[model samples]
Target chain A: MRIGKRSSKLMMNLYQRNKFKIRATTSNPRQGLLVATFLILVVIGADVFMDGAIRSRIRPMLVPVASFGRSAVAAVAGQDFWSSRQALLNENESLRERIEKMEAQNAGFEALRDDYEALQKMMAVTDEEGEKGLIAPIASSFRASPYGTFIIGAGFTKGVREGDIVLSEGGFVLGAVSEVNAKSSLVRMVFAPGQKTEVVSGSTGFTISGRGGGNASAEVPREAALAEGAPVRASIYEGRPIGIIGNIESASSSAYAEIHVVFPINLNTVRYVYIVPGNE
Target chain B: MSNMRLLLAILGIVFVFIAPPWLTAMCILALSLRWRAWEVLLIGACADILWFPGTFSYGIPVVTLFSLVVLIILEPLRNELLVDRRMI
Candidate 1:
């Protein structure tokens, strides 16, 4: 009788286990749909909530996460190694090019400096050298928001500050820092739809406003004597030259001048930037 | 669970994040083989949110609508392909 009871107890345990498994599998289909929906909602909500306040609080932690993702992919695809190789080749090429260009430019400078120095002496006669600032490699691209602007990945740790200037490679000022955090800062580029900037065209010597472009050339004042290929620079911050003036518009308003300045660095490909300290 | 699927998923996610406008379409095309219509749309939407978080506001509705249209139209075409494969 005791032996019979033990066998019956084992059978009962097997039946319960099979029933639990059946219930678990049966519920999984409905659970999958619910889980998918939950995930979708979360993704959407996170995007909506990623405003300045949240970003200011969260971005410090986020930087490491983003860098990890980038590095992991880069490692797996051998792109990191490839990029290092390419960078080495580029440095070698640039060094050779710089030497050649400097030699050519030195010859031209000798002739121009003779008269330019006299004009400079007459204007001020003070020889204060421009201070050199640190060149920080941009670790990542700018993070953009709707209510606010974009944030770059270099900050005070790299000697950047609120009023410091960001530059494109061709000596044009991109924008100034609207806000700065520990490791990164926000830059409000002059090309936002509502953004207006005062720019002096180096080639044309016309004072025009950069009204930004949507799909076509930025609108410039009809009377703002600017050619399409004119090089433009902006003093968004004092002593900083922003972007090159891009294509000129056939001005509609006879009163206002508008010009599109192409950002010196491809805004989309902004992997790195050089910050020029304002006080320097 | 398969290594191949995980590899593909990671590649798909990465493409969704950083792929330029031209390349995103290519990524979507590549994904058509293994993913259902809804899954592909969800992946793309996730990528957009990761990149421009600003797009999140307009992206959810737009992606959902786009995915629905793709399902309504492409699913019929896919059905034919699936039937052909099964027959072969």
Candidate 2:
């Protein structure tokens, strides 16, 4: 009661002090609107041009906060105790088989790497010919985003940079880093609406534009020998396969065929990605 | 009632990072219905800073733009409503 009385008194005192000015502004809504408009415009301008620098400074602080939220959610989910022992045993067995397969694949990859290095030396290509990679856990998903983007818990300090290529665990192209801060980065997925990329159709060498989302469409000539399930390769990576042709449609009247390409990786479930440091 | 509204607004700002955008939008709208809540603009700016990519990808700051629109459209309605109640 005492606090309420003091607050009312303080409010009355403030109102009395600014009574005339407040009345003038309230009576003339146009003047108030004009001032508000000007201020908003100034803010928007600053945000558009200077947002990167601001995020770069602020994201480091947000990283720990985001990590805490993630950990809390994980802990809550981990407390589920309804699964049977048999189910757990089956899952463990499957994991062991998967690990064995991965070990064999790793051995093959080592051999391939050695052969590639020899070829590179023969061609006089240096080790610095390509960018290095940094792995980062995804801090957030697109649940809050209207656009196709997610935040990764790695940033400038971890060698993540704007325009760096983001790839899945299997080296499939996922997206490119659009914004980089001190401790986090925003990756714009290849499947984002309105995003486009150049791709070459398998063997045909026909260069076409690929759109975003799990499925991308390209215009091919009706006479082109493109078929469904054919591989589509990224032009920038010199024919590194990124997607497969899902469908080919052509109208009898039109000279061009509409080809839809599908990405191999399920983009939604990706929890971590590798950031290949380079200019996009 | 005012305190409750202020508390909700503060929660809305924090929820920008942890909750869906629509929830945050709903919170801001609820606050606007009671008062001008000009701080919603700042909340929107913070959201943009935390989540929005640069203008190279998206042209405008969406949350701030929506908040400004709400303020512009709602301010006069609030004033007229208050005056009508006073007259009654």
- Specify the highest-TM-score model's number: 2
Looking at model 2, the pairs that clash are: A191-A213
lDDT tens per residue, model 2, B1-88: 2586679778777667666677888877876665656666766766776666655355566787887788667776767764332211
- Give lDDT tens digits, candidate 2, residues A168-187: 64566667788887778887
Candidate 2 Cα misplacement greater than 4 A, ranges: A1-43, A47-51, A73-131, A201-232, A236-263, B1-11, B29-35, B55-58, B76-88
Position A3, candidate 2: lDDT: 100
Model 1 pairs whose backbones collide? A172-A242, A173-A241, A173-A242, A219-A258, A220-A258, A221-A257, A221-A258, A232-A245, A234-A242, A246-A261
lDDT of each: 0.50, 0.66
List iRMS (one decimal) for every candidate.
7.6, 4.7
lDDT of 1 by residue, A92-181 (tens): 777868976895777578536744653343223122213444344343333222211345677777777766766544445555565566
Per-candidate Cα RMSD to the true structure, in Å, reads: 12.6, 10.5
Worst 10 residues of 1 chain A by lDDT: A121-130
lDDT of 2: 0.66
For model 1, the stretches where C-alpha displacement exceeds 4 angstroms are: A1-34, A46-135, A141-153, A156-164, A175-181, A185-216, A221-223, A234-240, A246-260, A265-272, A276-280, B1-8, B16-18, B29-34, B37-50, B53-88
